[model samples]
Target chain A: MKTLTPIEQLPLFTTQIKAFINWTRKNALWPLPFGTACCGIEYMAVVGSHYDISRLGAEVVRFSPRQADLLIVAGTITEKMAPVLRQIYEQMPEPKWVISMGVCASSGGFYRAYHTVQGIQSIVPVDAYVPGCPPTPEAVFQAVIKLQEKISKGDTPSQRLVAKKKMAELTSGNLENTGS
Target chain B: MEYHFQLVHQIKESLGDKAITSVETGIGNPFECVLVVRREDVRKIAEYLKGQRNFQYLMDICGVHYPNREQTLEAVYHFYNRDQKQRVRLKVPHKEGESVPSLTPVYKAANWFEREAFDMMGLKFEGHPDLTRILCHHQFVGHALRKDYPATQNQVCDAPEVFSFPPLPLNEDEDVLTNQRTLVNIGPSHPATHGTFRIYAELQGERIMRAKAEIGYLHRCFEKMAETHKYQQVIPYTDRLNYLSAPMNNAGYCRAVEKLIGIEIPARAQYIRVILNELSRIIDHLVCIGTTSVDMGALTTFWFCFRQRENVYELFEALCGNRMLTTITRVGGVYGDIDDEWKRRCTGVIKTLRETIDEVDRLLTNNKIWLNRMKGTGYVSQANAIDYGFTGPCLRAAGVDHDLRKAEPYYDYDRLEFDVPVFTDSDNFARYMVRMEEMRQSCRLVEQAIAKIPDGPIQVNDPKIVLPPKAEVYTNIEALMNHFMLVINGIQPPKGEIYSYTEAANGELGFYIVSDGTGYPYRVKVRPPCFPIYSSFEETITGGQIADAVATLGQFNVVAGELDR
Candidate 1:
């Protein structure tokens, strides 16, 4: 048997592992661009040369969902498109986060009518919401930073277990006053 | 004016009392000449007008619902004669279930327009091939543009089942070798399609055997909402249509209402409009060329173009408060005047854009790969182009000298000296060449506008249409009352209908507004150019390769915002 050092015995190794994992996750956020409308044009501006999204380490925008960790819903999602959005969310690997960009994705913006979904939150869980008709590239960058901050909190085996349990409870309709 | 009177006389003489019900010249307005015809005789009269009277171009076909009238639905048609530079409106009123003969046999462009009319107003066309819901989903319950439809009513629909492609028929010659063809779905959320446009292509190896384009995924019901919103309030909605060139839509709708109210804006406002509209054209062409190059595996040109686009966006931000969705124009005039600083910034941006375009042209014009990819792809005959009602650069690429700016001049376009570039070959490369030359012409127009802009008030002095200045409104009772009435009730044009067309970046962006002497518009129908251009996609890409289809779609530059609006 190997003997542990005093520092290792003090339970600092898990904390160090969590910090390293969180740092890597925060830095490399592969975004799946769910661009649909005018906000999609602004998203292109964010990915363009002047306000390059590569500065924040989110340059590789994957169109497919399986390889992505961040879903940027960048336009209005109509009623017919809701299931496709959910399917993309489910296809993304676990530990995924969503950033609802622009007012349409956040709360339907100026399109408050029959076909437009009220907000993307009705279809998928959103980690952050950027507000603008089609938000500027700077607003998109700020949203990326906010999402990084949220990601920096890190995840552990225990946290995953709690999340899975909570999801199960919610899906099973057993969410009876689990006090926050 | 003589031509307008002759058109009315000829139409009434040709179509006797059985076909022609009444003809009304717009009172106090010289532009509009409306002909009301019997519902059953619409197709015959349309053909007569096209064949005998040389009204070769069908500008728009839309429907208006009048709930309380004996005939509840009216289908309206706008036809333009290129030689005479004259336009006529045909209105056919019918009962709710009575069918109007389809115009698809006469003009193929009416395919999607008739579908839109059916989708919005529930007016059926008897002989139409595929008259299904176009701007709304198939599950939508009621016609949205009907006067009785509630603005707040929303229905929750079940998500559609996963699409299964129909099996392709086996060719008689190749049945033994290969029995199945592959079905490829390109978009609805693809980077290639630019927006929510879907193309389903049936491929035999590398060649696209058949392709069907499906739209309406981003249809936010703009026309329905326009009925409920006040006339001026619809400007923001127009911004979302063809969002890349929002100022053009803004200017088009405002000009239509201005014509209705018989208001000629100040010379300064018109010149400013010309400048902004030309700037929007440059921006739109930049995106079209940049994205086309990007799709063809060239990244450097995209970067250069987008950098220049950013500069143009900055100029727009300095002029208005927004970058992409700028609702800059108002009912009577523009939202603000261009100051010296804005002029300086615009000039700088135009210089940068010229330099960037020169660089892009040097890089891509003679590149062996670009020429090989673009030269012979997506060829359209002149007949097919006109049949599909192609306008703007698309029609120009097919060797048609049908630029509305030249044929039907509006807003001092006749005074401006700019060449309309045309090409004999109707391919992707020709379209690119036309757009490139158009960007140069737009730059020239902007320069001329800046040089020739007359100094005056940006807004008209009419308190009935334009709000008074803020300082005057704060101090003077008359100004305050005008401001209060304008804001509270909105601008009211006379009870009449006007069809106004502007040469937008895509094509002829027409706005047909029917005002009922009220704050809210009775019916507003937008003739978005992309609708017809997009309708021709399946025909364009049927025999091309899948890679060429993407390149051709980029050349077409169909903005889904306008196409599905």
Candidate 2:
């Protein structure tokens, strides 16, 4: 084995390594398609030949949470489906992001009723909100680009740490709010 | 109209006069006649209609809440006779505690409709075999469709307990049961089940012994919201019912409200509606065939189908502002007039779509694997299909030549020349063939409608129902006043109850609205076609392989939005 030089272990090398990691992660994000209603159809259109989300490196749709790094929640989430969404979010591997893809998924849109959840953010943190009753395929592509930009600028290691910290804060906050 | 009156007279004569309380004709509309029967005599009356009177088709069963009446809850059943080409509405009003006899024994299609009635309005069926909540979670509290229930109340709940299937006991006397059978649960999120539907299947070896389908993951309480919204506002809500065929829903709801108000739209608008409806049917069949092929492991056909679907969406975007949720129809007519450019572009897209569908047909129709997966997979007999109240392509595929457009034409559908495709195989492949042929017929209809469209006003001349153009409203005081009144007060139909049905892409999509001479509807019941089609799913997939379940479900084209709503 060759001996490591002192200059090879400098801070510059670590910064280059982190940049490379961020670049690759931003370019290739495997998405879990959590589609429930109308927006789901638009999501499929985005992945189809015309809008072609593959241009942005998001064509690989993973149905399982364990293999995906991005969660595209594409439609209305009812109260009965909230816990299941949270469980899937929990099941995802670390360093994941969620894109709330339509008006109903963002703020319940026109369906402010008994069964629908107000917005998915009540249960999980959202990184980007694509807003339309059912957002067009172009709008979905724009959201994917926005998420990619966030991934590019994000401090990869610090992002994981911040997500963990936020999860803890949300848990404690929910516990306190429920107690009163 | 005379036939309906005579049918009511016969119903009164067949059952004693004491069985029926009163007969109300022309209460709101001239065409619809209401027969009020006692709660206990509903079964006897339904049996008489089916057995003696030949009203074999039970179209829909729904509940209405009349808060001020002595009998607060009413169960309404819509029946049709294919041979006679007649329809009747049977109303049975009961108090809160009274239970209506289950009609499932008479028409097997009543199984899920009764469950939905119970789920929505708390109307109990006396002898329903599996009368659990069909469209709401088991933990849901008050009935949603009752007048007293608030529309905006949010019921926060925890994760539902994991549903456990009851243990299946093996027969010790049978020598075939040497191995243990396993129970498998497929999705409320599985990709193959399409959209948030769960099915539990008991499997012994590779064959499924029994299967039960559980729905309601996408129930957004549309009917509850409709009661609170104005009539015009409910049009957009219908778009989400079957997202693939949105314009058909818009036209269906608009026609129902138009029927209540008794106004006829212009010739140009009716032709435009026919064009849009046939276009929607084409796209719906495209999605169904494409998705079924994808589920059976043919990926290329999905791409080909979506390519055409994208073109159709582009055409819709040119007409309306949005693509999929095109709220394009108004109460009395369509939102805007179709220009020459739109007509040219739509024709071009339809031509391209025909070629694309042909390519898809060449790819999948003769493939050996596709045939093996779908040929005899989910066999539904003609008798069972009619008993289960299958409609649209599913019924036609079972050799029943019943098409609403042909039997009781609406919106100038009689003017168009088209063929209703029917097949006798009554299997998964038969459904595929029927949908494919229907797409060709729809394309022909669209071409004819575009060619024969007359030049005239798009909306009726009723300022009370339709808003005047902004140019007229800005310049003329009368137009401005009319626009102001319409925008503020909304469309108000007379007090009446009417059930309007259209041949939707999936089946016969019916809307039964009871009005109280108010801006808001008293009760709006959407009879989604998928409700009954999905009810027979368990029976269809019982003896088939587990893989065939996915293929069968995809061909059924059960959209969760309509099914749960």
Candidate 3:
């Protein structure tokens, strides 16, 4: 019995390693606030004295994307701001998750205008969504908890998209390479 | 008000047909007197008014679109005089392709306004130095504010903005290394920026040589979206303008619609409006001071102030279920009336707010570090302040002593007893002091309003303007039909335009509404107070240190929603 390499379509050892990695990530997710508009004020309340976000172990709020693992997009993503958001997302050292907070970021909210992006999902892969014009502080907390759950399960949307992309490349007329 | 007619006559005497064509002064119009100027004479008239007649403040320059008129677009200019307490409107009616003269040479504040007018309505100015799209993506094709542009046709642009600043000249004493100035871009998402505004600065050894701003990252098309919806439906959009004090925007918008429809809400509603607006002012000031301190690395002040801010937000949540975006005003009056518990909570929160403000005062008032960061940094003169269209506390801080509440009283502010805080230092610290004192004055006004509010109906009793009660609508046929028509067709104001302004948390929040006698408004232009405040930001921070820009920007309280809307 030869040793099974990772991504052999049935690597039990790889699954165990992935679970271990996800567990570590789930506990210490440093969040960066991509706050642009009104939802930013609500996010301030989240990190403020009343509803302190430190209890969830995600209290390390880094403004720079390089130091963050969870990007909490807290406002509207206009057309002029989309490329900046994309650059920020790409700059975060991989194994990152994005939580699209507020209806403005998730679906552009009531601002179906010429400047607003329809949803942030069109630009970055959002792992969770908090629904409100400016979501309450508790909704943001719920999103954090939900993101942790997704992290521990190793079923994040970004990972799923990567897997789908890998499978699409693998199935492109190279059946013997994987099926054999 | 007679001075307006006299001023028009004065202009007519001076320049006759070369300057102005006609004057609009009637008993029916509720706002300022209008002077219909010749299209080619905008710059000349503006210069004449500012240089000769003391119309120093260029308050707004906006484009109003009318499809059926022979001249499809009109560039409306609002000018104000601080010493005289006079505000006048100038109209330059022109076709789509016709070019009008730029008012930039007269008022330094006209640069951004003319750019905005161009970006929105495609109104070209002849002598504008660098007229470009100010509020839209560079790749945007059509002017979104025009009547023909589709409101929902959103274009997705993924290109990053490149910064280009006009270089400043090097001094004769500067060395070669100092002459090689480094250009640094601040942020659309930097921590010190506190909002989505990018500042391109040329720095020489941490001193800014030249600075410029490129905003519109939060331009959600507030005006374009307002035109697509009904009159009452636009209240929520206005609430997002300055989310810190949303009810103030609602009050401005609803009062504008009420004035257009000519419906007077009951005295109780008026009192409630005043109380709500004052509380919002207190909250806005607290947050502005708190956030500015946080941006400057003074963390304790943020905790002290935001704790009190949360108290006020809880008070707002008790009345309206939403915390931040409180769409709490209807067309005729408020969405809901206040109760004894809400009033008690208001007093309780104001008490806590005073304690917090005092605590913050004690912590930062004499701190040597805070003084070094704020005092004497970002100094602006009174002339530069008024020339750049500064208003509210910022203008008052510059020693102009102009408050819309005291100068042009609205919402029965003339009856209220309070002091307008004015500071002459005109620095970052002076602006902070003005805001702190303004909050205390607001508290005083709220206390008086609570004791003096009359007991009456909250909304107007007109079926055409205000909706009937739900119980009456369910029982009576006429009430049901009225409710159905009101909800279905919306309030149909006459085919006219009204410019209504109020003393908002930041400055004069004006609503310029043009109705086409239909459910949907033809065009809605919000004169956001933060617009001109930010247009002067480049000059305010030019000679200061990089950190001083952060301190001044935070104190300016330039809400991105209002600045780019």
Candidate 4:
């Protein structure tokens, strides 16, 4: 790690400062809800008139998956739904975050049996896990707050590097596992 | 008494001198008597019940597998009379792949019910016009509900051939009139489906000639999963099925298990159950009415209804600590008791909701545009509605006087006073009005239950069945041990089967639990109301306009979670 000398870094970091400002302004995300089950309902309630998550910049609830920057995996991922869920997560643009919003999404909750995907993390790498059978809108709001914190870290090195590396990794992993 | 005696004697006289195979009086009123009839006489006897005896409504067609019995499979038909208001059960046996004569010719409702029977249990219907899978995919093999079928994923299926429509013969990419109806898959991805559902519609110039619902995209095999989980553990799964009306499914499953074990809950617990159930009904109806209006192009009505629904969710969150798929009620009773603050807030919310409902009614009920969009659209004649075995608001909309609350009156419903609103026309408009009226009735029911709640214990006093209090379990060794065992292994019920039906927001949500003296249910069958209602979609929308399909199905409030379960 290199130390920052005030005078030496000031002129050099000026361009970086301008870029950070632009990134922060653009990345003030407005989530599009694609909620399906119990968690999806709570996700709506969180953004609805009561627990207004719009206060934290997610005012626009777009129904389509393409526009969302944060994909909240908020319900049970059954075998029939797994493919669609993966497709939706893949459709979302890069620099996205996933909030596993319930026990089901975190680790299949009460349905950690044969049909359910063991955890949503297996499909999309989750940034935060909201641990409850169906976490309250307040807890969901808190998870969003945590996502904002992760966002404020500026350049997510792990996310950028891993996202690039994982395509090949996933293809090979799928070959070994599901043999797709 | 007269109807029951007449029906019993009629069964004995009509079916020769065959001994009654089973007589069960414990399953509520109109005590069920099952008589095994030869497969050849099923349609003849069903026709007699329809033409002469006036058992007009084929309530349901279900198949029960008896592996050890002399006969292999028993296809049971539950019939109910419109005038006499009595039920009769008919049981007929079938060998593998053999046909039982279809009752569709007698009762049109049996068309889809028999299709479902064929899908899950592989009981063939010989005389049916179209015998296809209703819940599972078209290509899915293996009878899921068979006793011999393995419950887990390990029972591997030889993947069926995936057939795609032959690519349109290209003429240099020029569009041509092929004289073939264009097939459009309207969902399984579309927003209006509510869940993973696809409607394979054969469109002949925007008129759907054949609109087949291809479900099972969210098929979790809930019944098979129930067998592995303990009886108490299965309640959460019920919450997932009809997630919009979670409490109803939770209570329905719990009631079945309680009936099998003969566990009587305390009055306060029953009152709480009633309150939660009514609240769920109001919320579920709000979604239905809101979506119906939204489909009819009244987007503002959905906003109003959804705003009020938010408050309901808040009240639910306050009481149960979770909102959707609440898992509020446990096996023997509710998970915990509601305090005075939650009760007071709920009372105030219900009062405010009544005012909001009046505003909403003013906006959508009499509005000419809303009326035009709904008024004669998707009309199901009185006969067709009953013949399709529609229930809840959809049936009530068609002037049917059947409400499980009035007919069976479970959970002290008889003690409450409420009117079952019935509309004469079974159109989309009438269904919307019926649900709106029913929401008001649910509000009334909730207020009554809240005011009359007693000062007794909430849970039933059975340590073997109901786990001890959480605080007690944390402190006391004996309580902790009971909790550990109960949570780990599940509560065991006596070796018996019980069917308990609840008037869910959609329709009759019944749970049939077969317990073999074990902690987990041997086989838990769910009678999801949406399956039958959605099955009637193609029949209802045959000659109607394209937009009527959405309005009609929206009024049905067919949640795919429950429909495909």
Q: What is the TM-score of chain A alone in each candidate?
A: 0.80, 0.80, 0.79, 0.74
Q: Write down the worst ten-residue block by lDDT for model 4 chain A.
A: A171-180
For model 3, how does the per-residue alpha-carbon lDDT over B184-251 read when each residue is reduced to its tens digit? 98899898887899999999878898887998999999999989999988999999999889999999
The list of candidate 2 runs beyond 4 A from truth reads A1-15, A155-158, A162-180, B1-10, B25-33, B173-177
Query: What ranking of all candidate models by DockQ puts the best one first?
Result: 3, 2, 1, 4
- Residue B283, candidate 4: C-alpha displacement in angstroms: 1.1
User: What are the per-residue Cα lDDT tens digits for candidate 4 across B320-403?
Assistant: 766676888876788878889888998999998898789889998889988888889888888887777788999999998899
Q: Tell me what TM-score chain A of model 1 achieves.
A: 0.80
TM-score-best of 1 and 4: 1
- Write candidate 4's Cα lDDT for A135-174 as tens digits: 8777887887777766665445334554455664866653
Task: Give residue A128's lDDT in candidate 4 (0 to 100).
Answer: 78
Give a tens-digit lDDT track for model 1, residues B223-328.
Answer: 8778889999999999989988989999999998998898888888899899999999999999999989989989899888888889988888887889988899
The stretch of ten residues in a row with the least summed lDDT in candidate 3 chain A is A171-180
Docking class of 2: medium
Relative to the true structure, candidate 2 has a C-alpha RMSD (angstroms) of: 4.2
| Prediction 1 TM-score vs. true | 0.93
Model 1: reference contacts kept, as a fraction = 0.61
User: Where does candidate 4 stray beyond 4 Å?
Assistant: A1-32, A64-73, A86-101, A120-130, A142-180, B1-5, B19-30, B66-72, B93-98, B128-141, B146-150, B154-181, B296-299, B470-490
